[model samples]
Target: MAGSGETSEARALGEALAALRRDCGLSQAEAGARIGMTGQGWGLYEAGKRSSLFRPDVQRRLTGALGATPEALMLQAPGGAAVSTDRPKTSHPDNAPAHGLSARGRAFEGAASDVRRLRLETDELAPWASAGTVLEYALGRWPRRGQGCVIQLQDGLRKVRLYDRADEAEMVVLGAGALDRSERIARSDVQSVSAVISRLDDA
Candidate 1:
């Protein structure tokens, strides 16, 4: 349940993100591609339509993709005061399941704070996310249609795919390519899903 105050705040933040991206001279599709999202999906964030855009992890990654910090995306308050970008620290137990991983099964280092990094080890995500590309994803943020995602299975495995849709019994995902073949998986097999927030081409 969201309160009125929160909604207003999200709207302000969204506007800030939009302005910043425009300042960088990137169109919605171009900016979204840098962050593994579709033009429409990124537009939603800028339109202040998705409440999840307020999440600290999401904020960090989105702004980071634009070469800015989270603080830079904060909206001004009443009387022109600046909103704080501070966020509470997230805690996880030592034995808790990690948020994500690389395709090679190696643990992603330094992603414990906000976003996880996964290196593409195969050509399955080619062109869009080719081998050697490192992807940044935000935990707890669900990707919109046509957006790429990192899905965690019950067995602790992760897969990167373009999100399609889901129902009570299953989730649909599409492979990255011109064909964009879709696959269906039982809902029971999925443990969680995260939105891929950025793509870094590895040299």
Candidate 2:
């Protein structure tokens, strides 16, 4: 049940999304696969069937995949500015190439406050974070027990796990969902740990 303004915005957003996808030469299914969703699921966004497109987290994933911005999609404009309908010139982030296709695109400008985006690659943390899910992790935020986290180990291995507990000597993490698995690793083996602040829904 959206109001007239909301509905209008939704339609406009959908059209922009559809256009962006086409410009990138990606099919709905291929676009969906990048974010861990089915083609129908992705189409819903372009069809303006789901309100989640208005959500900041969801916008990050959708626009990131398109190599565009929220402004590019007309989702948000600065200082209460009116969104322009002109096609935005796509701009990649400064280090966009280094991260390959995994980096968060210049999209979600307002939502990128000290946040970095990473795509989940495995289902080890399934249900909570299955493969294809996109995670927005805070750069320096510490994770409390029972929170999702990205752990970078000294040996250069990175893992996504639910934070269990941590001490000066070691850290404990549990597999999310019904996996019923846990592991403890020495603190010395860890390089960094950051809290996963938000997950973009591709479901």
Candidate 3:
């Protein structure tokens, strides 16, 4: 959650970026010209913090112009602090609790530490986005892109994934016998998914 002051403070950081440019005595056009977004790009970047998808090159230029560290500019961003750097590799510096799994085995045994980790806010799994969670997703096609789609959903009984956003009660059916049929359809021209929770509701 955003602290009441976080968004405002972030905008202030944008303001700082603008001031840094001016202190360097370059017009927005001139400053942006050196970068690539143009003066218009500079204005948008500083004033409208809402739009933050900038190219890595642009980020590098702005970082240099602002005389501020990238970390300083991106503090506590909800989408995440903008950076051009590659993701930090995972490491288990803390030895595992006396569990059977080794450090390597434990990497994915619990909560993921990166973006996915953010989405898992509940021990029992939440149906909606939580503090650190991204929605669970399924890959399939409706009508448009046959390649696949990403939908918010969850798995049940350790064998199924669901597409809760699909307007219909469609769940990824997994099992050994009848489920083999749907799994086959999913691999090809599957029109709709089956809903399994209905039967398990009383369970």
Candidate 4:
């Protein structure tokens, strides 16, 4: 469980995210689309009035959607789980994940240090990352959801699409030059979104 202090910090970030969403004149779903989230993932983020920004990829998506810097969305990510305090010394959320790892692994490797350091600071991530509960929608439909990722493999920026409709699932256009493969995506090309999955809702 997160400490009382961390819980308070998470609440602040939530408010910041909601405020940013209002400033954009968009709903949670719309915000998610901006970052390439779709279905349940995008909706949960926006609806998470008391929820915290749990993943680094989610934070990045929020920053891009809000047109804010990495620092802007940093605070939105709250402190919880073993990943926060149990790790090597680290700093910088954007530079942490190290790329080329699963969302959970990346969360531990890169964002973990950021989380610990966050504990020392206030219950925020530099006051920039929390601008809103930004999300990523379905950027493409090549290998199917959870099978591919839309990201800037080199720089770590996401290459995703915004919201769109289809038969299989929803899509969000995150980037113009979305990558693809032969019925499968090269994991190295996409930023595997981080999340601590629990049966909550569906898209």
Error of 3 at 159 (Å): 54
Show how many residue pairs clash in every candidate, following the order shown.
Answer: 0, 0, 6, 26
Candidate of highest TM-score: 1
Kindly indicate the candidate among 1 and 3 with the higher lDDT: 1
Please, what are the lDDT tens digits per residue for candidate 2 over residues 137-168? 86434565577878777677888899876544
Ten-residue segment with the worst summed lDDT in candidate 1? 99-108
lDDT of 4 by residue, 1-203 (tens): 76776565555555556665676577776666544566356555544433436555344445445544234434333432222222223443534554432222121234343221111112121121221323332221122233323333444554322222222122332223332211233444554332211111213
State the lDDT at 82 in candidate 4: 28
Better of 1 and 2 by TM-score: 1
Model 4 ranges with Cα > 4 A deviation = 38-54, 74-188, 191-203
lDDT of 3 by residue, 65-165 (tens): 33332443454233345422333312213442211101111112332231121133332321222234333322111111111122222321122332222
lDDT of 1: 0.67
Report the Cα RMSD per candidate. Answer: 8.8, 14.0, 18.7, 16.4
Q: Give candidate 1's root-mean-square deviation (CA, Å).
A: 8.8
Give candidate 3's error at residue 128 in angstroms: 62
TM-score versus the correct structure, for each prediction: 0.46, 0.44, 0.30, 0.39
What overall lDDT goes with each candidate model?
Answer: 0.67, 0.66, 0.35, 0.38
> For model 4, what is the error of residue 160's alpha carbon versus the real structure, in angstroms, after optimal superposition?
12
